[model samples]
Each structure stands twice: as structure tokens, then as C-alpha cells.
Target: SFHHYETPEDIRSKTMEWIEDFHADTERNATLWTMEKLSKHDGSDPENYPAHVCVMEFVVQVGADTRTFPSWKGHCVTRRNLVHFRGLSIDKNDIRWNEDGFRPLPDLACCLEKEKEYLLQNLETLLHRGGRIVARLKEHLEDQDQSRYTLP
Candidate 1:
């Protein structure tokens, strides 16, 4: 979406040209557009029905450059966790958004709460398993004669 600033036409054109040039080196098809047709909602669709994002991967060619991104998820970080903890491939600065800034999803609290409870519930088992493994390692180390080990 282009911003509707009440600026002169020439200025706007130059600004847009500059912006496009700045992003010219970036990969093509890096931006995802909303496609309503041949979507996931239909029963005949092989992909998940009523999917918000396209799970399918696609390639787009722009001049001599070729770029690829998933149907819906594309290169943008849409989730709350992704906004904060972008995976290895994503750069925070490159996140796509039409707004002045990005905001994490509003439902992140519930997800965080569930994650906290899950961690709490599994903490004991994890600790117990760690303790057993450490004890076994210590026992094995004790049984081995240190002098018999050779350094590389």
C-alpha cells in the first residue's frame, strides 16, 4: 500500500523511485500478496482447507533475478515468537509490514502461559533424567583409569 501523503507528484515519484532502487538488489517474489482464488478453503484443494497462508512453495522470476517464497508465510514474521525470536534465516529489519512499526500478536499471552505450564510440568522429569545421566557419566568416569586415556 502506498502512502497517500499530500505531497507534490514529482517529489512522490522521485521518492518511490529511490525506494525501489534501494530495494532493487533484494530477491524477487519476496513480498506476498493476497490471492483469493484457488485458495485453501475449497474442499477439492489438496492443501489444508481454510488455510490463512499458502503452504505451497512457488517461484517468481523478475527480469534476470529469481526469488521464491511460500504462499502465505512468505518471508514475513507473522507470529509473536517470530517477531522477537526470528529464526536463523530471517532478519528483523527485513520483516514486511505496512505499518510504521510491528506489533507482536495479541494472543501471545495465552500461548506463553501454556508454554510456561508445559515447562513447569516437565521440569521435574527433565531434572530427574538429567540427574540420572550425570550420575551414570560420573560412575563410568570413575570406573575408567585416567592413566589409560591417551591425549590426541
Candidate 2:
């Protein structure tokens, strides 16, 4: 039983809903760890500075029993808690694809290029602001004068 839509808007909305549901399902099975939340000394404590990050592993699986791909051998931090780092390879494969068979080269390339452009455009601000943020954290730690405050 098929009900054809009369308008593109109806079709678009239905498609969007379907895609949203699909993503929801995928996220249910995926593991997500936030470093800022995970790295805190106490469960209630907040992170004073950004963590030196790295990707421990990445693997693509289908359902519980099927292993679609092996875990990515190399370690690289593709993203931070908020900001994304570029040129990190998640796997040996050149590209990853979705269930709909859409290869992510174009999208990844676009995202990487946009990220690079953003970094280039804001390099001075990023460096200076980042330095200032670090300096402020250092000053706070120094004012406290606690050996425990220092990051290992």
C-alpha cells in the first residue's frame, strides 16, 4: 500500500523524519565519550583546561554479531570536545560510507577544507586566544600554588 504525496514539501518532511529516525537508531548503538566530562578528578568537577586528546580506536560494526570493518589501526585525534582537528585518519580505508551507500569523500573534503579555511582565517585569534586561555589557567593554578593542580 503506497500513498503518493502531492507536494515536494510532504516528501521532504517524510524523508527527513525517516533519516532522523535512522540516525537515532545508529546513535543508540554507538559509544560516545566526552573527555571534558570523563577527565574530571571528581564526577562533579569541571575541566580547567582542554585535554591532550587522541583517538584510541574506531571500528565499524553491523548489528551485534557482524563486524563490517576492523578497528582503525592508527591513533589520531580527529576532533576535540568542541573544536575539530583536521587531517586525522580514522581508518585505513580512504573513505567511509553510510547505509545508503553515499561515500563521504565530498562531504569530508568539504568539511576539512572549511575547517582549514576557518583555522587559517582565525589563526592569529586562535593562537592568541588559546594562549591567553592557557595563561589564565596557569595563573589560577599558580595563585592556588597546588602541586595537584598541575596536569600530568
lDDT of 1 by residue, 37-149 (tens): 31332233324532222211111111112122332222222232223332334443332333433222222233344433332222222222221101111111232333332
Q: Extract clashing residue pairs from model 2.
A: none
User: How close is every model to the real structure, measured as TM-score?
Assistant: 0.17, 0.19
Error of 1 at 42 (Å): 49
Q: Which candidate should be chosen as best, given lDDT against the real structure?
A: 1
Q: Per-candidate RMSD vs. true structure? A: 25.5, 19.5
Q: Where's the lowest-lDDT run of ten residues in candidate 2?
A: 131-140
TM-score, predicted candidate 2 vs. hidden true structure: 0.19
**Regions more than 4 Å wrong, model 1:** 1-5, 27-102, 105-152
Q: Pick the candidate with the highest TM-score.
A: 2
The local distance difference test score of each candidate is 0.28, 0.26
Per-candidate clashes come to 1, 0
Residue pairs of candidate 1 with colliding backbone atoms: 54-72
